[model samples]
Target: MSIRLTPLGRMVVPVLVLVGLIGLNGWLSATMGRGPWLDVDKVFHLAIGIVVSWVFYYLLRQKHDAVPHYGFFGAGMMLGASGWFPLVSQGLLFSALPDWDITLFGIGSHRNPAFHSALIPFFLVIGLLHYRGMRDFAIGLSVGVCSHLLVDLCQSASSHPDWYRPNFYPIVRGMYGPFAVLWMLGNALIAAGLAYGAAGRQPALVRMEREGFE
Candidate 1:
């Protein structure tokens, strides 16, 4: 059965979906009794975030005045490179003989509690900038990022495995492959959305303009 949702309703649906995904990940981590499961949970969480962003954009495009904001995409790319690229490329900085195992001040400290704390602002800022003058984008990204942080906190409280420690750490090594998948999915969806916006011939935002929430 097809039931139509109001603009706000449409927006809230996706946000709720993202929340449920994050919560599920945390719960799964708790169930697994380790952090490796948490990484798997996060991969799903990131995928949900990508989907929510897509839906939010689809809804926002419905208005006549709703212009595709190329700036947000540009900003997202820059934020990824400047803030996230370094962390992802940590392996590249060291020799192949042995992985770096230093503290936050040195190698092998990438998953330190201090580093996680520092990541909050970075992710939040990127989320906010992803919105880039659009309420839906801002809301979606903010919720997604906050949910992620909560998941992290939950995992931490569970005393799960960390990235730096091996014997004590429960997480699977080199799980970044999953993150790569999520990141690639997000980028692909964003590119499609931008293309749709630019096409301008067939608008993707199918809602009525009179609703005032394009």
Candidate 2:
């Protein structure tokens, strides 16, 4: 089925993606380094971001326009935006919020809720627009958000010692300096990979298969 984007949906997806890109850029400036933000993390994030979007589009190739192009794009953008929220929020509050005063149940990263909240609505709208019911929407939302969060948690807790700081409550920390830049680079690449996987032709096909089952 040939898919098309509703005008409003078209506008929304790109705008959200652009905003997400901008936020990451700002975060790179603040956290990575002081000199013109020559951090590799930003480069990785941008590259991965594009790759994720492209890969997602690719995987859905069979469904080319099935999910409604803009709808898929919007869903992807929502995840992207949400993925960066924690970093952006922390950057914003880094100086303002005391090290000992930040928690809504002591979640380590700000990115968690920021992305998940936005993701649910994004997928919900995608479902509504496609006249697809709640199942695909929920799956998409859960997969997108949970997948991203799982990566973050894993990176933070295990593989990426340099990317984030290990601490309990009130003071969640991430690394700084060159190593920090590398950490962001790694995370961004991983995010992009997940996005690509979810949004990819295979994933989209899986979604379509699930839809058929329902």
TM-score top scorer: 1
TM-scores for all candidates? Answer: 0.34, 0.33
* Candidate 2 lDDT score relative to the true structure: 0.40
- Candidate of highest lDDT: 2
User: Per-residue lDDT of 71-107 in model 1, one digit per residue for the tens?
Assistant: 5532332222122122232333311111122322464
Candidate 2 TM-score, true structure as reference: 0.33
**Each prediction's number of clashing residue pairs:** 7, 10
Per-residue lDDT over 1-214 for candidate 2, one digit per residue giving the tens place of the 0 to 100 score: 9879775765566657656665665566568653332433324333334434444544456455544245545453434323333333333222111111234434455433333233343445445432343333332433344334333343344434443433322111444434443443444444434433434333455566678843
Worst 10 residues of 2 by lDDT: 92-101
> Candidate 1: which stretches are off by over 4 Å?
33-38, 64-214
